[model samples]
Target: MANSNDSWFQTTAAREIHLEQLKQAERFNGRAAMLGIVIGIITEGLTGAGIAHQIGLGPLVDGYAACRTQFLPFCF
Candidate 1:
């Protein structure tokens, strides 16, 4: 605990770093969310590709068809 006369600067550097990291965390939450969404899209797209392959739609169309879930982002 700190006295009234003491500034937070009086705390250990590790404690200060922890508080800084918390502040940084607030900024990173949105970035993390976006990253998760991107990962989800990629996984879903790969899944679609596997389905296309299983259906034997031919390599070209099937390859594209499989990943169309990902392409939806651009086609929109």
Candidate 2:
């Protein structure tokens, strides 16, 4: 009876450790999301500049305004 109880305890502990590892992986992704936001800001500036340079600021702003009215993400 004692050995069987010990085995049960060990399995429960292992299960908890696995759960914590999964939680840690999700938090790690949240940290990576911060980096992604920084990258997105840089890309947004570059994209706006590229559009204005190639087309014109008026058209670039118009396109962004249209997207803002129509889409969820709004071009970026």
Global local distance difference test of model 1: 0.64
Query: With candidate 1 superimposed using the best TM-score fit, by how many Å does residue 71's alpha carbon deviate from the native?
Result: 34
**Candidate 2 lDDT over residue span 1-76, tens digit each:** 9999999999999999999999999999999998877776676687754433443454446577557576435663
TM-score quality measure for candidate 1: 0.33
Q: What is the lDDT of every predicted structure here?
A: 0.64, 0.73
Task: Show model 2 residue runs off by greater than 4 Å.
Answer: 46-76
70 in model 1: Cα distance from truth in Å?
34
Report the lDDT tens digits of candidate 1 across residue range 1-76: 5574375555666698899999899779978988877776776587754433444654545356446656333332
Report clashes for each candidate as comma-separated counts.
1, 0
